[model samples]
Target: MITSEKIKIYAHYYGDSDMWARRAKSSEKAILSNDWYLIGSLIQEIELVNKGLASEKFTLNLKKHLIESCDNQETIRQLESLLAMNK
Candidate 1:
């Protein structure tokens, strides 16, 4: 999917829990529940319905997606910085 479409999907999932979504949006680190797995193995790895662990690989994949779909410049900069370190 294109980044824009993925962003919409992300927003839709987050929008389900209105209050929790607002809080998650405001927080730097948020563990959200959604069946939005970009990495297939994550499905097997996670015991919870939609919760994913913050493994190095998972984190990298997420950041890459956000960098593609996120509009926030600061957030992209932060993600890229972190990505550089991982590489």
Candidate 2:
């Protein structure tokens, strides 16, 4: 599940209600499609970008979640590659 913390990160990154609303709609679509992994990854990436080391482990875990949740082989491969690089 995509958390409020993640949504907050999206909201913060976008920096406007309209943009945030659009993101929220997209997030809802992702959720409905069971593609929450993408949203989770995106949020974690934003958190890492904004907070750096404070979010390193959190981002890594989110990447793991992406690995577990992703159905697309290419996406899983890319995420695995990223996780390996991060390690």
Give the least accurate 10-residue stretch of model 1, judged by summed lDDT: 39-48
State each model's CA lDDT, in order.
Answer: 0.39, 0.48
Per-residue lDDT of candidate 1, residues 23-42 (tens digit)? 54532213323323431222
For model 1 the local lDDT of residue 14 reads: 43
Model 2 has an lDDT value of: 0.48
Measured by lDDT, the strongest candidate is 2
> For this target, which candidate reaches the highest TM-score against the unseen true structure?
2
Question: lDDT, candidate 2, residue 23?
Answer: 58
